[model samples]
Target: MGVEERRQQLIGVALELFSARSPDEVSIDEIAAAAGISRPLVYHYFPGKQSLYEAALRRAAEELATRFVEPREGPLGARLLRVMKRFFDFVDEHGPGFSALMRGGPAVGSTTTNAMIDDVRQAAYEQIMSHLDIAEPPVRLTLVVRSWVSLAEATALLWLDGREIPRAELELQLVHDFAALCAVSAAYDDGMAAVVVRILEQEPLEGPFGELVGRLMAIAPTVMEQVVADDRTA
Candidate 1:
């Protein structure tokens, strides 16, 4: 293969290995063997395993960042659900590599790796904000968006371990979680309330946010009954 072709081949091989296990567990010899080349030839293309890992990480990070992008033609809740599905698709495919990138072990702990992770977070944040279509978002609105982004990252990292929760359920729950966050903030801030109102205006009863409303409403009578009983006792 040519020099560029050889480098791309090595990166592809390394990414596959990294996806199966943490980057630290994979060695130069293994990468070279996987690429069907000598260990020294791997060095000729890249200086060491660290460089190779970073290259693979860059590719993964770029893909992960793009997962949050969706066309702004649907209800916000639906848009978010589609984005979540794509995000989980990446996590499901690159479990070990995603974990290493987010959790940070000795092998993957470097300035470059951390920056890539941050870039993914920022990209996700910007995408959500654009979906909101707010010109000047309030401080609380900013907090809600950024916090949801972090929550999504943490949720994916925890889900990678054993994956106890059904993936589809988690995806829908995350959409609900975003709405809940905005709703709670909206209660206190007029700006946030306007944002929630605008989002709900575009939502449908069958959508995730509307489903959350239905679920909450279903238990409202029981909750209110308990509250009335406690008030009478008091």
Candidate 2:
């Protein structure tokens, strides 16, 4: 193989192993063994174990960063549903590696590792915000976006650790959670309220927002009935 091909072959082998195990647990010989190559051949592409680990991480990180990049031309809620589906798909495929990337435990983490992870988070945040078309969002709006991004990361990590929650369930919940946060932010802050209303107004009734709004309407009577009954008793 050519020099570049050899380097990528080794990196690909390292990625598969690293995804299945942690950095400390994987070694140069193990990677070479998996690659069916000599130990020295592995070193020829990467200087050392640390270098190989970083390369593997970078490979994963680049793919992850691209995963969150979605088109801006769809209904906001629909776009979110698309992104959530893609997000969970990545989680399902890269189970162990996905968890390691999100948590960044000190055991196998360094500045480079954390930076790559952060890049994924930041990319997700920016992609979501980009749909809003706001050059500068308010403090509360920023809080809503940032909070949801962190929540999504934690949710994905938990989903990896405990498979009890189905991926589809998590995906649907995240889509609703994001809209709920937006509506909540809008309720407390007029600036946020206007922005959210504007986005939701553009959404068609057949979209995810339509379904969620229908659910809200269907339950409104029951919720208001309890409040009214309590007021009458008082």
Candidate 3:
């Protein structure tokens, strides 16, 4: 392999090792053996184990960050669903590596690693905010957005940990939960309420939001009667 190709090959090997285990658990000698090269050759590309670990993480982080980006066009719910699918796909492909990166297991946790993780979190948050085209949002409005972002991260981790739930169902449920949160947040904040109203107005009836609103509208009367009857029973 060419020099650059060899470097990437080494990184690929390192990433596989990292995914299977942890940073500290994988040694320089093991990496060299895995790559079928001498220890000195591995050192030529990466100074040591830490550099190799960080390089592997940086690659993963870049790929993970890219998955969060989706076209800003179309309904907010549609856009979010697309983004959520990309996010989950990454989790499915790199569940162990992702878990280590996000949760900072003992072997990989450190100041530098945590800082890198924070950068990925901020990038995902900014991607959502940028697409929303929000400016000077009220405190509660911003809080709601941030909360959803955090929830998405936590939910992905949990979803990976327990495979009992199908990914498609999780994605749809998350989208619905976000819509529900918006409705709840809007009830407390007129600013958010107005924003949501504008979004609903602009949303095409064939999109995710449209489907959600139509379904909820259809079920509202029955749901409301059930709630009232339950209250009476209590």
**Top candidate (lDDT):** 1
TM-score, candidate 3, is: 0.87
Q: Estimate, for each residue in 165-234, the C-alpha lDDT of model 2 and write its tens digit.
A: 8888789889888888989888888899888888888798888877888899999999999999999999
Q: For residue 33, give model 1's deviation from the true position in Å.
A: 1.0
lDDT string for model 3 (37-121, tens) is 9999998988867777777888888888998888878788888889889989888877777788888866467788888888888
Each prediction's TM-score versus the true structure: 0.96, 0.91, 0.87
Each model's lDDT comes to 0.91, 0.83, 0.82
| Local accuracy of candidate 1 as per-residue lDDT tens digits, 39-134 | 999999998778998999998999898888899997888999999999999999999999998989886889999999889889998998988898
Off by over 4 Å in 2: 228-234
Overall local distance difference test of candidate 2:
0.83
By TM-score, the better pick of 2 and 3 is: 2
* Candidate 2 TM-score versus the reference: 0.91
Model 2 poorest ten-residue lDDT run: 99-108
Model 1 spans > 4 angstroms off: 231-234
Better of 1 and 2 by lDDT: 1
Error of 1 at 170 (Å): 0.4
